[model samples]
Target: MRSSSRLKRAALPRSAPATSAGGSKTDGNHGLIAGTAAKRRTKKEADDAQGPSKPAPKKRRKVIPVKEPEPAASGSEASTQTSHADTKQPEQHLPSLPLDVLYEIFSVLDPHGLIQLTHTCKYLCTVLASRKLDWAWKVARKNSPGLETWDPPKDMSEMRWASLVADTSCSNCGAGGVTSVDFRLRMHLCEQCSKDGLIHSSRLAKAYPDLLPIVRELVPYTNKKLHSNKKSDKYFWIDDLQSMDKKIRKLQAEDPSAVDDFCKERRDLVKSILGRASYLRQWHARYMESRVDFRMDQIAGRFQAIGYQFEDLDNPKFYLHPLVRLDTPLTDAEFAEMREVLQPVLAQIKQQRTKAERSSKVLELYDQYKKTLLPIQRIYVPDDGNFLWKYPKFSALLTRDTSLEITDAEWAEATDALPTYLSRFIEAKRDKHIALMHDRYPAPDAMEFITLAASPQALQHAREETMPHFAGPLELAIATFTHREDTVVRYNRLFTGRELCNSWFEKVKFQFADRESGLVAQMVRMAGLNPRSTTATEMDDLGAQFFCRTCHNTDHERAKAAQEPHTLWACSWRGLLDHFRGSHPTAIKIGLVNHEFYTLERTHNVIDIFENWCCNHCSEEAVAFLPRQAADDHLQAAHGVLTPSVGRDVFFRPPALNVMAPHGIQSYYQFKDSIPPQASLSTKEPSPTS
Candidate 1:
C-alpha cells in the first residue's frame, strides 16, 4: 500500500505541497495533495477570468519644510545658538513622553525633588504648573515623609504650597538659608527679610493710622517673640495690609453699601487662613526637624564611611560643626570638598581626647605607685616626692608604649631598675650644677678652679662672691628636679629630699654663717674689741658704728642731692657687711665713727625709722614701706613668718635719712649708753651709706 501511495503522489504532476494543520509540509498525505491541487486549479481559472492584477498606489505623506539655520553675525551668537540647539534637543525628548508617564514619574518624587525638576527647564515648569498635573503634586505631597499629614490651604496652589514649604529661600529677596515658613503670610522669609517686611502692631498705627484697626482685624498675624518671657508683638505682612487696604478703598468707591460686606468676607477669609496656618505651622516645624535629623544622619554616615567609630559620632566637636548641623542633606561631592578642613579638625580633637585618656591612665598608675611602691622604694633611694615623674628616663619607663594595665611583672621590672635610675639622676644633677657654675664663672684653667673649690678658704671666698649674684646648688636642684615640659612650673611648694636636700641645705647655711662670722670679726676689730671674744650682742650694745671710706668720698654728691646725712655714712655691724657685699665687691676701707658723732647723726637723720621699714619677703623691689607693727602683722598674716629679722628680713629705706650736722671725734663709750637702743634699730641705717 505504501508503494501504491508513492506512485499516486508522483502521478499527481508535482502538485503544490500540502501543509498539515500545524502548517508543516505533509509529503505522505495523498488526500491533502489532491485537495491542494484542486484549489490551485480553481484559483488559476479565477485569475484568468479576472485578467492581470496590479499593485495598489501608496498614500502621500504631508511634508514639513524646515527652514535652514541662519549664519551667525558673531561668534557669540553662533555659540549661543549651538548651545540652545543642544539643550533644546534633550528637552524635546523629555516632554515627548506621554502625559501619564510624566505624571507617574513625578508622583514618585518628593516635593523637594519635584520642585528641583521645575528649576531644570521651562517645559517642566509649565507642565508641572498645569492644573492637569495637580493630582501629581498631591500624590508627591502624600508620599513625602513629613508632609503626608497636612494638605494645602483652599486658596493656595500645590506648587505655591510646595515652594513655601520646600524652598529654602526668602520669597521676596530670593536669598538662601530660609528653612522656616510663614504659613500665615504664605511665604518664606530670611531673618533680615522678616525684619524688613513685617510691620509690628505698635508700628502699624504710625505707618498707616487709618488702616491699622481694619488691617489688624482682617489680616492674619504672626507673633514676633524674640525671647521666651517677653511679650510678643503682633506682626502683620506689609504686603497683606497694602492689598487689603486697596481692596477696602476700591469697594468704598465702587459700592459704599458693599464695603461692610467686603470687610466681613475678608474677616471670614482671615479666620480660615489663621486656622489653616496653625496646622501648617506645626507641619513645617516637624518637616524642618526631620530634615535636620536626616542631614545629621547623612553626616554621621559619611564620617563612619571614612573609618570613624559609631561612638565618635556623639562627640560634640563633630556634631556641633556647622556642616554637620545644616538642615540640608550632605552630598558626596560636598563631603569631598569639606573633607580637607573637617578631617584635620576631627584628627586634632581625637588626638586631644587620646592624650587626655592616656594622661588619666598614667595618673592612676602614678597614684597606685605612690601609695604602694614608693614607701618600699624610699628605703633604698631618697624620696623625690611628686618630682619623681620629672625625671625623663623614669617617666619613659612608666609611659613607654604601655597598655592601660600595669602588670605585676612590669612593676617588678620597674622596682628592680629604680636604684639605677635614681643614681643616674643624681649624677646628672651634680654634673649639671658643676657645668652651670663653671659656665657662670669661667676660669683660665678648669682643673685649677676645681682644685681651689675643694679648699675650705677658697670655697668660702667663692661662695661669698658668687652666692649673692648667681643661683646656688639648692636653687638649681629645685628648678631642675621640679621642671615640667608642658606648662610653666609653679614653685609654690618646696622640694626637699630627706637625706639629700637636707644635707645640702645644712652645708649652705654653714657656709653662709662662716662668711657672716668673718664680716662680724672685722667689725669687732674696727670697734677696737677682741675679735675672738667680742660677741655680736655686746658689740651692738656698745653702739659700734662704722663708715665706708669709698662711699663717704664718692657718694658725697649723691647724698647731698638726696638731702641725706652727708657728714659721714654710718652703719651698724650687720649693715656694714651688707653694704660691703652688695655695693663694694672690691676691698672696702671702713673706720669706726665716734660714739658721740654717731648718736648725733642718728638723732637728726633717723626720722620715722620704724615707719620706713619694709618686708623683704614680700617686697622684691623693697618699695613696700610699713610701720613696725604693720610690718610684723603683714609678715605673720601674708607669709606665716613670725619675729622677722632686722637686717635680713626688714631694712631701712635710704630716702628716709635727712641731712645731719657734722660732729667732732669723741670716746665711743661716752654716748654708747646715751642712746636707748630698740631691737628694730639694732641694725643701723644703711641708707645712702656704706
Candidate 2:
C-alpha cells in the first residue's frame, strides 16, 4: 500500500472511512470532490516520502486524521465542580499502530507472512487487501526464496499472486487443506475440493448444451492433473463455471464474431485454443516437475552426503510437510543440524558391519572344509588319520568350535595358509590312483587321460566341435554323459559305492564284458551306429567313435606323443575335450576348466578313412575315419596319387555285424589296453579281469 494510504489506515474514520469515489455507496458529486482532494493530498505525500530515489532512509511520519473530533466538555474550560468520574468517561480502544511502523514490518516480512499478518487485524487487512497495493506485494514477494522466482502472469494482480501463495483455505469450502493454487481455475483448493469440485470438460458441455462450442472455445481442457483416466481424459474446474458464464456473456456483448458468425468462429476458436492449451500444458508440466525435482534432489543429496538413506527410512508425515511450501521443498536449518548428528552414528554402523562380515567369512570357510573335503579325506585315506593336525595352523582351524567367533586376522592365517598343504595331500591321492591304473593298463600318459575324463565341461564342448558327419553317434554318447534330467538315477543307481573310483581302462574293458558280443563284433556295431557314413568296416583305434582328425582335445599330449592309438570310445565327451584343448590351450596347460567361449572348427576328412577297408578313392568307409587330409597324404606321400575322397564325406552303407543282434556296448577285448570312458550313463564295475 502507498505510504499516504497507510496513513489513512492509522486514522480512518470509525463510521465513514474514505473509499473510492466510484464505490457503490458514494455520496454523489460531493464524495467525488472529496476523493479528488484526497487523491491530490496522497500524491503530495507520496512525492515527499520518495523525494530521492537513491536508497534513502524512510522518515517517520506523524499522521493527521482526515477529520478532527470535536473538543469534549471535560476540556481545560470544564466546570471545576465536574466530578472526577464524569471527567474520565470510558477510554477509546487503543488506536492501530502508526502506518510507518506497519510499513517497516511488511518490508521485512515474507510475502506469505505479510498476507497472514494482515488477517489478524481489521484496518491492516483492508489496506493490504486492495488491488491498488500491488507495489507493496511486489516488495513482499522478494522476501521469500521460492516466491521471488515466480513471474506473475500479466493479467494477474499482486493481490491474486499473494492469495495463491499464502491462502491455505480452500476457495470452494473454506477448508484449511489447500496444497497449491489451481492456475487454470484461479483459486487455491484442498484435495477434496480438487477431486469433487473439478469436472471433465465434457461435463461442462453437457450441463450447458446451447453454449458447448463457445465453452470449448474459451475454457482450456487441461489434463495436467493425473487420475485413473489421465491419458485420454481432460478436466475442467467446476468452481470456474460461474465466472466462465459471466465471461462468455461479456464476450458475446463485446465481440461481434461471437454473434455474427457463431458456429464456425466458435469452432475455429476452439481448435486454436486447444492447440495453445496443449503447448502451455506441456511447458507448465516441465516447469513444475523441474522445480519439484530440483528441491527433492537437493534434499536427497544433502541427506545422503551425511549417510542418511531417506527413502529407506519410513517417511514420517509430520517431518515431511511444512518443509515444502507450494511444491518448493526447502531444506532449512533443522535438516542441516540433523545431518551433523547422523554422521557420527553412520560411522558406528560401518565399524559394526566390518566386524560382522569377518565373522561370516570365518563360518563359511569352516563349513565348506567340513562338508566336501573332510568327507573325502575320512573315507578314502584312512592312514592319514589326524594328518591335518601335523600343521599348527591347520590344527587350529579344525579344532575351532562353531559357537566361538574368530578374528579376521586369525581366520585368514589358518584358512589362507592351509590351501598349499591341502593341495599336496590331494596330489598324493591322485598319484595313488595313477599307480593303481598303471598296474592294470600300464601307460605313460594314463594320468593325463584320467584328468580329462573327470572334467565337468566334457559333454557340451564335445558336441560343438564334432564334425557334422559324426555328430549323431558321438552326440548319443554326449546325451548319456550329460543326463540332465536323470542324473541322480545315473549317479546313484549305476555309478555308486565301490565302482565310483574304478580305473578308466577297467571301465572300457567292461563295455564289452557283457560276454555276448565278441570284440570284433562290437566295433562293427558302433561303426554302423556312427553317423559320419553308412560305410562301416573296422576302425584303426578305439577313438574312431569321436576323435577330431586335426586337433586332439584333452591334455593328452603325453598319449599323442607316445603314439597311443587315438581310441577308447565311451561318451562323445572326446569332442568337448578336443575343443577345450584346441581353443583354451592355457586352461588345459594349467589344468583349469575355462568357462570362456571356445571353438574348434577343424576339418577331419583325412582321419575318417585312415583304416576303413574300402578302395581309398570313394568308399563311405573313407568318410567315416575323419582323416581326409591324412588319407590324402597317405595316398599322395606313400602311393604318389591324390585321393578324390579328401574333402567330400559321404556315408554309403553299414557292414553286416558278426552277431545277429547288435554287439554289446561294452565289448572288452577292443579296449583292454586303453583308458576307460567316463561319459557313459551306465557306470557298472568292470568284470573281473581274466
Candidate 3:
C-alpha cells in the first residue's frame, strides 16, 4: 500500500500526519511484513479485538447531488438499538508509548514534513493535535534551527482551543493556557514529522541499510555517467576503492585537468551548502543584542535603574552574559592588608597627580597608582572613553553662590590663547601623529553634536530602531565648554540622540594646524582643571558631560534645572550622533568609503591588513597596538623592523561596531573559561573563526 494511503487508513479524520492503530496508519501491521502481503483490518475490528467485519458505509449524496432524509426503521427501534449497542466495542489495544519517548520521537521532524503528515486521517490527527503534543511542539520550535520560521495554518488556531475543552486536561501537563485544547494543540505541533514517524516504524532498523533510498533511486543517473563514452564518475564516492581507482585511471586518460577542476568545483559546492551552519549559529546573536537594546531603552522610563550614567554602557559584553552575584565576603585579614598596603599608595599617587605638569608626568603617576592600588578595592573606569582624577559631579563641585565666578572676558581670552599654543605643540611632532585637517576633524563646539546623538531604543527593531531623545541644554553646554576636537567629533558624529536637532548640511571642522596640542593644554586650564590630575572618572562622561557648567548650563542654573530631561540630552557625550543621522540624511552617507571599510572590518579581514601595515613601523609605541601573538610573530619574521605602510594597501580603520577579542573559536573558549570563576560568563564562546 502507498505510504500516504496507509497513513490515511490508520487515521480516520484525515488530519493526523502519520502512523496509527490497527486500522490506523500507526498500526505496525499496516505495511507488509518483509516478504508477505499486507492485509486490511476493519475499523471496528481494529478498534477492538473481534472477528473481521467491514465498517458501515458512510451516507452518500442522493442521485441529484442533494441530501435526502432517511426513512424510519421498520423493526422495533428500542430492541434493535439494544442489539446493535451490544455488538460494538472500543478500539483495539495498541503498543504502549511513554510520554518522554513520544516527545523525543516528535522533536526531530522539520516543520515542512510535519505539515504534510497532518492531513492523512482523523484518529491520528486527534493524537497529533493533543495538548501534550502542543507543549512538545513549543519546546522543539524554540530549540530547532530553522523551525522558528514556520507559521501554522489559521483555522487550526480555533480548532486547538476547542480540543482543549473536550479533553479533561492535557495528559503531559494536566494543565491548559488561555486558549482551548485544539488551538493549543495546533499551536504546539512539532516541525519534524516524516523522519520522526519513519524512525518509529517497526521496519526502521532493517530500512537503515537502505536509508538513502532517494540516493539509491538515482543509481540510473550514476550508471549513465559511469558508462558515458567521454565522461567518468571521478567525483562520486564509491565504496569499492578498486572501482574508484579504476574510475580515476579512466578520468586521467580522458582529461586530467578537467577532472581536477570538476573535483574542485564539487568541493566548493559542499562548502556552500554548509554555509547554513554559519547563518544558524548567528541566529541568537541578534536576540542577545535586542536584550541589551531593551535594557538601555528603559533609561528614560526609569533612570535610577542605571547604576549611574557616569558613562554610556561601557561593559556591553559583560552585561549580555549571565549576571553573577559576588557573595563572598572579605576576611578581616584581607581587609587589613588591603587598607595598609594599598590605601596609602593610592593617596600618594593622587597627590602627585594633582602636581603633575603634563600627560607624560601623569603617565608616571599612573604607574605608581597601579602599583599602590593592588588588591584593588576601588577603581573607576570611564564609559565612552577616557579618565578623570575625580568622580564627576562637576556642576555641584564647581558652582559658586555669586554671579561673578569667572568672567566672560576671561573665558574669551583663554579660548583665543588656546589656538596658537596648541598649534605650536602639533608642529613640533608633526610627523609622529596623523594630521587632523579642518575638513575632516570636528569643531571645538562639536560636543553639542554628541549631546544630540544619545537616543533611547533599538534605532532598529528588525529593520527600524528609533533614535534616543536628549534635550537642548546639554548640547549647548557641552559644545560651549569642550575644547578637544577628537572627543567632540567622536561624540557628535557617531551617535544619534532623539532630542537635539542640527542641520547636517552645515559641516564644521577643526584643523590640527600645529595647534591642537597646546589648545588641549589651554583647554584644561580654561576649564579650571588639570588633565594630569584627571582620573578615569573625570575624563569620562562625568567630567566631559557634567563638569563644564556651560555644558550643564550652570551659569543660568534655574533655567537648566527647568529643562531637566532636555538638559540631560544636551550634555550627553554620545547622543548627538543619532540627532545628526535623523535630522541630516547627508551626514550619515557623507563618509561612504569609511562605511564600506567598516563592513569588512566587522568580519575581521581588516585586522589582517592592519598588522601588515603596522609591522613596518618598528617603534615600540607603534607596535603596541598589534595583538600579542601577531606582534610576536612579526618580530620573528620581519627582523624587528616595523612593517612600513608606504607600499601597503591597508589603512587603520575604526574598530568594529562592537569590538571583542579577535581570537578564533578554541582560544576564545579557553580565554572565557579562564576568567575568574566567580565572574559572569557567556555560554557561547565568541567565534571569530570563518
The C-alpha lDDT values of all candidates are 0.53, 0.41, 0.29
Tens-place lDDT per residue, model 3, 579-672, is: 3323443322111011111111122222343442233223334543465356556656655435422112111222322112221111001112
Compare candidates 2 and 3 on TM-score and give the better one: 2
**Which residue runs of candidate 3 sit more than 4 Å off their true CA positions?**
1-149, 152-314, 320-690
Model 2 Cα lDDT, one tens digit per residue, 364-390: 664445333311121222222244555
The deviation in Å at residue 677 for candidate 1 is 40
Provide C-alpha RMSD values for all models, in order: 25.0, 19.3, 32.8
Whichever of 1 and 3 has more TM-score, that candidate is 1
| Clashing residue pairs, backbone N/CA/C < 3 A, model 1 | none
Give the per-residue lDDT digits (tens) of candidate 1, residues 1-690.
001111111111211122234534333333333564797698778767776674334534333344577666666878788768966776766644544567678978878778777767767766666544567788888876677776766666676676778777667666678787777677676666666677677777777767736757877887653222433567777766777777777877889999788788878978887777778778788888887778788877888887976666768888788877776656679888877777877777766665555455445544444333211122222333234456554465445543255456765565555445545544454344435321243221111111221455644443344322122332221121211223322221122111123233121211122333455556666566765434333454466667676775566567558966445556565456556655665666666665433445332223234455566443233335566667778778886768765433443332211111121122222224444322212344332223
* Arranged by lDDT, best first: 1, 2, 3
| Steric overlap count per candidate | 0, 31, 100
